[model samples]
Target: MVTFAIGTDDFVVAGALPAISRDLAVSEGTTGQLVTVFSLAYAFSAPVMAVLTSRVPPRRLLGLGLTLFAALNFATALATSFEILLVLRIVTAVVAGTLSPAAFAIAGQRAEPGYAGRAIGVVAAGLTVSLAVGVPIGTWLSTRWGWHATFVAVGVFTVGALVTVAATLPRFEPVSEAGIGDRLRALRSPAILACAVTTTIGACAGLMPYIYVAPISEALTARPELLTVFIATIGVAGALGAAVGGHIADGWGPDRGMIATFGTALVVVLVWVGLHATVAPVPPVVIMGSLAVWGVAAWSNNAPMNARTLALAGPVGTEAMALNTSGLYVGMACGSAIGGLVLDRFGVTGTLLAAIGIGVCGVAAMVISVRRWPTGRPARGKAGKKARV
Candidate 1:
């Protein structure tokens, strides 16, 4: 639920950008900066917070993070100026950054021997559902009551999440209690660095087309109002894909799972772009189906990615997830910026083509990372510590 609220807030802006721009007397392009600010804030904040709170109990940090998140959303709902809104968003994002990695780390800590991937996937499902369901509902609320109502709704959801988390989540100490040097060393490992690079690049590729989905939908359906449907299609597919990927990771290992997921995404985008560029104007049904496929292929890799990162980092799984989360946001910021530039210069088809190229680079990086450090292959390091998947 915490994730649901955070994810909803993270994505709802995409649907509300036009309304916000109109109300704030800013260009839609300027409104888009809200997302960029949040992403960049999160990219930088997660690691610092993870380290600062390394000794704090996971349950306590989770509670505080959600509380801050809800309060920030409420404050955002009341903001009357773009400057205030931007400041509120940046603070909210810094708080939001602390929640996800904590959730994944806790899930990994409590999960049964072989079920870590599934546990992480279950938590991640909240984010996927937000994309699928939350954004559309927020969009509807924005159109009806106003964009402010959407922020209030997210705040209300977070209240429920906070209650549930407090009542149900078990308190756990930090997994490693490793000092900064240890955490930094974990991040500096060849395999860990490679995986982080792959994750960032892959996420950037996956999100390139996603950031400009409204225009892409407008081009496909010729009815911008129907953009919600296309967005929902991606969300729905993402939810299912996360579920499937979890099981696949547990069975075949995260490496194989990510390779499959990323490879499939590459193909799906290639086909979608091909049809859009050379073939007939694709029908709404076909376009929606392609969006589903793209979402599924793109979003499925996160659980495995998290699991793999934890495995590679060994005892420093918490810190590693923090870094990985940072990478994810960095990719989001980059993808949004790249997508905006492409949209201005090349249009929707051009954005998709660029996504194809980025996806190829992402896949190549993943392949190299896996071959260099095979998933679940025990690596003997300091003091005979075995990095096991």
Candidate 2:
């Protein structure tokens, strides 16, 4: 629930962007900056926070993070200006950054020997569901009551998440009592840095089309109603993909699993782009199916790759998890920003081609990591860190 609440808080903005722009006397582009700001804060702060409070108990940090997240959403509900809202969004993002890493780290530590993947998948699935349920619901509430009310609802959900987390999450001892300098040392590993790069690039490839989804739908086909359906399907596909990826990762080993996911996703993007010309003016079902396939492959890359990254950090598992999560958002922000620019300069097809190129680079990076570190062999244990499906 805490994980889903984190996802919900982030996704709520997508549905409310238009209203937020209008209410704050800002342009829609500026409204999008809200996402940019939050992503930036999340990316930079995630690992750093873990590194800073390396000695802090996971349960305490989780509780504080949840409370801060809910309060920030509450504050966002009361904002009267874009500046205020943007600042408060940053604050909320700081809390949001820890939610996923902590959840995954805890899940990894608690799962039975053979069930780590399933456990991590369950937590990640919550975030994916946020896109399906939270985004649309927030959009609905904003349309009906107002943007402020939408935020209030998210805040209320956070309250529930806080309660559940406090009750259910285990209070585990810190794995590393190292100070900031010590935790930061984990990034010094060349292999570790390579993992971050590939993960970021892969995420970039996946998100490129999403940032300008509206324009892409407009350019590819005449009927605009397919747009909403496509987005909704991607959200659902992503949730299922996350859940399934965990299972896949546990079986195939992390490196191989990521290779399959990233490689297939790259091909799918190219296939989708190639199909677009033929898909134009088609039945909605075909387009929906294509979008769903794209979501499934693209989103599936995270778990196996993430699990591999954490393994490199040794005892400082939280720090590594934080780094990967942060990189994920940073890549999303960069991809979305660049996609917007590419869309303006070259239109939808150009964006697709550019995204494919990024994916190719991601594939190359992952392959290079495999050769350098070869962390695909699973260790025999139910404790410490584990990879995705």
Candidate 3:
């Protein structure tokens, strides 16, 4: 529920941008900065906050973070000035950065033997579910009531998440009592660095085409309404993929799971490029089917990736997760920027080919990482001591 609320807060603003612009008397482009700042803040803050709060109990941190997050959303809904809202969004993002890594770390730590991947996947599914369900509902509320209503709704849901987390989550001590310097040093482990790099590269590859899905879809289909259906298909498939990916990691091991998921994603994207080349204006059903596969392959990789990072950075699991989160966001930003450049120079087809090339690099990075630390085992280092899952 916490992940769902945070994810909804992150993406829901896109749908409400026009209304927010009109109400706040700002350009839509300026209104869009809310999202850019949130992502940048989150990417930069996660690891730093994790280092600063390393000794805080997971349960306590989650509770406090969610409380602040809820309050921020409510305050954002009430803010009359865009400047205030932008600052509030940045603070809210910092809180979200704190909550998410702790949540994933706790889920992995508390899972029963051999079920860490499944547990993490369950938590990750919340984020995917938000993309599928929460954003749409929040968008509807914005259109029906007002843009501010969407923030109010997010706050309401976050309050529910806070209550559930406080009441149900077990109190766990910090995984490591290391000082900031020691925790930062743990991040230098080769295996940990490799995992982070793989995450960044894979995210960059997967998100490249995703950020430009609208234009890509337009080229494929004449009907505009089908774009909505295509997006819904991707979201639903992604949610399902999260669940299945966990089981794969547990049964096949994180290394194999990463390779399989990423390899499948590469193939799916290649198929998209091939279809576009061979058949201009491809059938809508074919596009939808391809998107479903792409979504599943792309989103399913999250679990094994998280599990891998946690295992490698055993003593500093939360810190590693935070770093992984940062890497994911960095890749997202880079992917969007690169995709825009490619789209401008080469069009949608060029964009797809560029994604494929980057994806190949991503897969190669994963392969090299797995070779270095086969079976997701941690490398020989202090950070790798007592590594789990």
Candidate 3 residue pairs in backbone clash = none
Tens digit per residue, CA lDDT, model 2, 297-329: 766776787777766767667778888888788
Q: Using TM-score as the measure, which candidate wins?
A: 1
Task: Give me the candidate number with maximum lDDT.
Answer: 1
Off by over 4 Å in 2: 21-30, 177-181, 221-228, 379-389
Write candidate 1's Cα lDDT for 1-389 as tens digits.
87788889988888787678789998655676787788889989987887778888878988988888999999999999999999999999899888888888877756666677877888888888988888888877887788899899889889989999899877666778678898778767888778778888887788767767777777766777777787888889989988887777777788889889888888887887777667646678888898898888777888888889877777788778888888888888777777777777778778788788887888888888988898762222355332231
Clashes of 3: 0
Give TM per candidate.
0.92, 0.89, 0.85
Return whichever of 1 and 2 wins on lDDT.
1
Which segments of candidate 1 are over 4 A away from where they belong? Answer: 278-281, 377-389
lDDT, model 2: 0.75
lDDT of 3 by residue, 1-389 (tens): 88888878876775566578788998544565576577678889999998988888877888888999999999999988899898998898899889888888878876665677888899888887876777656666776788889899899989989999888877768767667887898778788888889988888788766656656776766544454466567778889989988878877888889889988988887887777777758879888898889889878898999988877786788889998988886776566667766776777789788888988999899999988887543223243232232
**lDDT on C-alpha atoms for all candidate structures:** 0.81, 0.75, 0.79
